[model samples]
Target: MRALVLRHDHASQPGLVGDRLIERGYDLTTLTVVPEERFHSPDVTFAFPSAAEWDLVVSLGAPWSVYDEETIGTWIAGELALLREARDLGVPVLGICFGAQALATAFGGSVEPAPFPELGWTDVQSDIPDLVSSGPWFQWHYDRCVLPPGAVEIARNVAGLQAFVAGRSLGVQFHPEITAPVLRAWLDLDGGTLCARLGIDPDELVSRTLAERPQALARTAELVDAFLDRIALPVG
Candidate 1:
């Protein structure tokens, strides 16, 4: 099967998720929306390929908020249209963090600043424990997605909704594809400053993640497996 990965940030790369997808015999192609030079200020010139080109679409996280139309208006609009088109054409989607917010928005939901932001690892409650587990999931987001009408929530925590299913799409608020190197790049890009403000030591956060790499990697594999076998298959 052909899979499309839409990477929204320079810092966020598909780590274990890509590995697992390849292992499952998927031909994956990454379509990067923003140029490395214009990471913060994304240009909307990039357009998505037609639904016939890809059987699945995975939208990665970003540093920007989905509701920041005042700034990333053109890009957000284009993405919204693209996501809507993907849904209409019956393509299965997996959206993470900001990508989840975009999915929510496209499916009759809204994204807004959360009352409490999740920065580090956090525990969550999932309907399917085997497919989705609670505890120590990597999180880094300030916005939250309101579940679309008729959507089934997959996981959640005290902060807000964590994961949900809308039609053939899965939206996750946490970052399951994070690796030590990717986390480090994010920390270097003002994430460490946010950690500092939250009384969290950036070094410790990175160290903890690096230490738990084995478990996190396995968890990501399971997540992808569940996505393909459970969500993606049902829709595809």
Candidate 2:
């Protein structure tokens, strides 16, 4: 099967999730929205392919906020329309972090700044641990998704709703795609300063992520298995 990954920035490579998809026999091609020159820029103009061509779609996270329509309104508007069209066409979608926020916004829901952002490892609460487990999953987002219409919430934490399933789509607030080098790549790009401002030490976060690798892999394997067997496959 072919999986079209909507990559929004340089640091937001599919990482572990892409690895999982590869293991599951998926041919993955990422469509980068923000080009090299616009990689770090908030306002960008790009194109999204017709959703009918792919078996599955994944929208990865972005540094830019989904609600920043004043600046990226045009870009975000196009994305929302694309997502809505994908959903209408019954294409299964997996949305991560900012991607999830975009999914929420596309489906008659909303995204807003959280009371506080989740910067590092934080536990999640989910009744369906087989599909969604309590993490200490990697998190780095300032916004939260309000559940979309017909969306059944699958997970949560003190911060807010962590995951939900809508039609053929699964949206999660945490980053299951994180890895040591991925974390390092993000750190290389002002992650240290960003964490420091939040009173989190980047080195410590990196250390924890490194330590969490083995278990994280296994966890993501389970996540992908269930996501494929349950969320994507059933519909696909």
Candidate 3:
């Protein structure tokens, strides 16, 4: 099968999720929206491909908000349109963080600043443990999703909605694909300053991620398996 993995910026990669998808017999096509050189000025023209061409679509996280058109105006609308078309066509989507917010917006929901940014490993209350696991998943976001119409919220925590399902798509506010290197890359890109401002130790965060690597890999694999078996494949 073919999978289209949307990497929102230079830093965010497919990571463990992509690895599992490959193991499940998927050929991935990764598209990077914002190049590293253009990180300062992220308003770059990008044409999102049609969702019909891929067997599965995975939208990764981003540092920007879906509602912030001023920074991402060049491609956010196109991406939202693509996601909406995917939903209409019954294409399975796995949306993470910013991607989840975009998915929520595309499906008639809205994104807004959270009461406070969630910036570390956190636990969630899962309504459907078989599909959405309740655990300390890696999180790094400043916005929350107001679930779209017909969407079933599967999990949540003190922050807000954590995971929701609509049709053949699943959107999660945490980053299942996060790896130590990915975290470091994010930190290299002004994330360290953000961490400092938030009183989080960057080195400690990276070290903890390294320590959680094995368990995280297992959890990510289980989530992807559940999503494919219970959500994506049934309709796909």
TM-score of each: 0.95, 0.96, 0.98
Off by over 4 Å in 2: 234-236
Model 1: residues with Cα > 4 Å off, grouped in runs? 234-236
Clash number for every model?
A: 0, 0, 0
lDDT measured at residue 132 in model 2 versus the true structure, 0 to 100: 80
lDDT of 3 by residue, 1-236 (tens): 99999998999999999999999999999999999998878899999999999889999999898988898775999999999889877789999999999999999999988989899898899999767778779999989999999999999998899999988899999999999999999999989989999999999999889999998888899999999988886552
TM-score of 2: 0.96
lDDT of 1 by residue, 56-116 (tens): 8889999888888666657787778778888888888899999999999988999988988
Ranking by lDDT: 3, 2, 1
RMSD of each: 1.5, 1.4, 1.0
Candidate number of the best lDDT: 3
On TM-score, the candidate that comes out on top is 3
Q: Which candidate order results from sorting by TM-score in descending order?
A: 3, 2, 1
